[model samples]
Every structure is written in structure tokens, then in C-alpha cells.
Target: MTDQGLGKDDKTPRTARGERTRRALLAAAAQEFGEKGFHEGSISGITRRAGCALGSFYTYFDTKDDIFRALVADMSGQVRDYVSPRIAEARDGIDAERIGLLSFLEFARSHKELYRIIDESEFVDAAAYRAHYENTAARVATRLAKAAERGEVRPDVEEVHAWAIMGMNVFLGLRYGIWDDSRPADEIAAIANALIEKGIGTRPD
Candidate 1:
């Protein structure tokens, strides 16, 4: 079978214990790659961090590159799972974006290594890197479209608008969330949301 999406290939785990090991390896990889980077990080280091045997690595992953690819996909899914629900609880479309950014900021601040692993994926695995952002942008676009239909945003909003907001959130997460993190999450999100609220936000009657 083809390597479609994250769980691609027949090497997939078949048992509950297998899944736990895979998760441990990915978690260890995040810390390894996040700190040592893809080039410097070693498979040995991952196993050591995961407290698993050396040979056990091959049980789930074929090679170091393979694990890294899976790591990228895992991290992307983590962000979505973390932010999507908070975004859903938002009062409206514009508020949804605010919640999304706020949640992302918290995630980035806590998972400092997340950006490093993802950024390195751009160099190590271009396809996975592109897929992460493209998939995220698509989600944003869908949300915006629904918001438009519900009169939450400007009637003329388009895909470009969603991409723009996603771009904004990405950089904001990098800067305020990952880089400095001195400011409060709500404060930073509100500042960014202000620009969005006026431009895309629907006016009150």
C-alpha cells in the first residue's frame, strides 16, 4: 500500500502496546530533533530518550528519515487537536480565530521544540512540510467560508483572506508564542485580532 497521509504503509502498529511505543518514540524524537536538530539528532538518542531497545526502533519505523516524517505529521495533528475545539467554542467566526490564535500561542510556548521540528522538516522532507501548512490553510479557509455564510464576516471574503489569517497566526505563534513569550496570550491575540476584527469582522447594525 502507498504511504498515504500519516499512518501510511504496512509498518503500522497492530496492538495497543505498539501504539504506545510509537507515541513514545515520536515524543522522544520531538525533544531530540527540537534540541539537536535533524542533522545532529541520532536514532540512538531517540531510543535512549524513549527508554526503548535499539532494535525496537525498526519495529515501527524503517529509518531515521521515516521517523522524522511521522514526527512532522504527528506535531501537525497535535496542533489541530489542541486548537480546533477552542476555536469551535468561539462566539462567532472572528472570535473563533481569536481563540485559535490564543490556543496556538499557549501550545507553542509550552512545546518550544515544536517549531524546530517543523522548520527542519522543510529542509529534510519538503512534502511533509508543505502538507502541514496546506492542510492548515484549507481548514482555515473552510472556517472562513462557513463564517461568511453565517454573516460573521464580510460577504466578499475569499480563500485569500483565510490564507492571510493563517499566515498571521503562524508568525504570531513564532514571535510572541515561541520567541519572546513575555506578553500574555490574550493580550497578543487581541492585538492581532483587532486588525482582523475591523477588516474581516462584520459590522454591527
Candidate 2:
């Protein structure tokens, strides 16, 4: 009845428990969605898989669509977390490009579920998906710009080049990482790094 709603002690435990339940649900939802596309997935199925009640799903998400959106956001954040540090260490120019390419492949290998979700989402919801992809590319471009300024890559290279390199990684992930037979993640990363760096590396006059 008070502004605390259920009172202090009650509210605290409820909030903590709710958060834990919500995170579990989302984790399960991401796995389900990645395995089965959004259209084929259901709230009941997600809740069942998560071991939560039907009504509890609404406490965290109003609908399946809401859950999907949240999953995309979470997956994007995970990718950024995985790649940002490696990119940060690339203060040396060529190493920046090498790091960026390798980091992307490694991230995909580490989070294949999230990567599959992202890839499928792009075709079904191009606008929302592209916005997130472009934002990531922009961040990578900033790193590339710094490297270019330091003579790491060709000065004439544009941010689009960064986006292109990222695209190559995405397709490679689709073909080799996700679909093809197992190969070492490092070996795949090395192949991608070679392709991107060779194309982008500075050439002597």
C-alpha cells in the first residue's frame, strides 16, 4: 500500500529473485531463438525451456517480440565486450587491423549462438539489424582511423573499408565457422586477418 509497494524487505528479495529469473529466461530464449528462428519460437516453449511459469515471462518481456529485441541487444553487447579490448590493444597500426579481424572471428567462435541470432535477424529485420551492425562498424572505423593516422593502413582508406572488412568476417563465420566442418578458430582467424590486412595494408610508391 505504501510507495515501497510490498514494503522494503519484501521488495528487495522480490527484485533480486525477479532479476535472476529474468536473466535465466533471457539466456534460454537466446539459445532457443538461435536454434530456431523467431517465427518458429514461442513464449510457452521459451518459458518451459527456462523452467519458469507462463506469467513470469511477462514480468520480463511483454511478448515474444520484446524478448527477441532484448536478445539482439544482449548479443550485440556481448560481441562488443569480446572485441573491444582486443581492438584497444591495437595501438600499433597493422596490428590494429590484424587484431580487429582476429577478434571478430574469435568472438564468433566463442558466441556462435549469438552470432547465428544476429545473422538470422539481419534477413528478417534488416533495419534494426543493420543499425546495430553499422554502429559496431563505426567503432571499428574509429580504431582504423587512429591506425591510419599512425601510418598503419593506407591514408586514403575510408570507414567503409572497415565495414567491408567486418562484412567479410561475418560471411566467413557463416560459411566456415557456423556451417562447415570444424577447423581451429585461430587458423580461421589467421586466414581472415591475412585477407583484410593484405588488401588494406599501405603500399609503397
Candidate 3:
């Protein structure tokens, strides 16, 4: 896949050192935007936080909006990278869904600023915001379709089911991971997974 994490006009970093510097800038941007927001976040602030010279900023990013857009895409990839391996460890399709939710909660707790950056992206970079969710839902849909082929889930499972699960996980992360973490992540995942196993309707009508 193309590095959507880079600015539209920016080229990929060549040397290992260049790659490290670029990653450092992205990390700093996350904290900058997470605390002050896109409108208030400054290039100088990111450079200072990254421990790089102000001139170094121009080498990686063209403008503040460019970095902010890149940050949103970067964070989206971070979440997927963290959770994908755990999801792969699941024994079956349903268990994979459960593992996915549990990993996401853990990630949210550790990266509290995730919500701030992603939520603000809706206004600062609408395209990146929509792409984030759309890409995630597509992954879920692909998984569900594979499970159907394996006879691990209902044959009729489709894209609608993928989006439904995504919606449930997003809100659950906000409520349990951001608002509060008094509840156990595994416990929450188990409760949600049952809905996948058994329809929530009064009967399978």
C-alpha cells in the first residue's frame, strides 16, 4: 500500500535516519494536535516536541494542515498494526471479533489521545476521517466473508454485519476506553461477542 501517512507532496524518507526523524515528527504531531487541536497546533510546536530544529520541519512536511492530515492517517495505521496480530491469533471467526475489540480497548487506554486526533480529523481532514472508518469496515467485511466460507459463521453474513460490528466497537471504545476503564476489557469483549454468536432480535425471524 502507498504511504498515506506522508504528505501529498512529500517523498518517502530515504535513509534509516530520515525514517526515524519522520516518525518522531509524527509522534510529536499526535501530542500537539491531541492537546491543542488542529486550528491551534503549530509547526514550531511539533518541531520543539520532536527535539528537531524548526528548519528540519520543512524537510518532512510542507504545512501544518499537511502534517495534521498525515497524522490522522498514521494513527489509523498504528491501531491496525497493534490489533491485527492479536486478531490473527483467534481460533475462530467469532473469537477473532472478540480479540479485535479487546485489543482496541487496550490500545485506546494506552493512547488516550487517539480519540482526540481521530475525532478532530472529521473537520480538519474529512477525507482521511472517512477513509479510516471505511478501510476498517472493509477489513471486517473480508474477515466475515472468509468465515462464511469456513462455515465458522452464518452463510448470509455480509457487509452490513461488518459495519454493525464496527459501530459497536467504536462506541464501546469511547465509553469503556475513554470515558472510563473501570470495566474489564475482556469482559466487555465477551458481552459484545455474544451478540455476534446469537442475534439480538427476539427471535431469528
CA lDDT scores, all candidates in order: 0.91, 0.74, 0.91
Q: Arrange candidates by TM-score, descending.
A: 3, 1, 2
Q: Rank the candidates by lDDT, best first.
A: 3, 1, 2
Judged by whole-model lDDT over C-alpha atoms, candidate 2 comes out at: 0.74
Please tell me which predicted candidate would have the highest TM-score against the true structure.
3
Score candidate 1 by lDDT.
0.91
- Candidate 2 C-alpha lDDT tens digits along 87-205: 77865766666676666667666666866677677766676698788888888788778877888777987878878877877787766666662877667767777776675557784
Residues 1-205 of candidate 3: C-alpha lDDT, one tens digit per residue? 1235555445567889998999999999999998999899899999999999987777777788888988999999999999999999999999999999999999998898999999998998899999999999999999999999999999999999999999999999999999999999999999999988885789556
Worst 10 residues of 2 by lDDT: 4-13
- Give the poorly placed runs of model 3, Cα more than 4 Å off: 1-10, 201-205
Locate the minimum summed-lDDT window of 10 residues in model 3: 1-10
Stretches of candidate 2 off by over 4 Å are 1-14, 200-205
**TM-score, each model?**
0.92, 0.81, 0.92
The residue pairs in collision within model 2 are: none
Score residue 13 of candidate 1 by CA lDDT.
Answer: 88
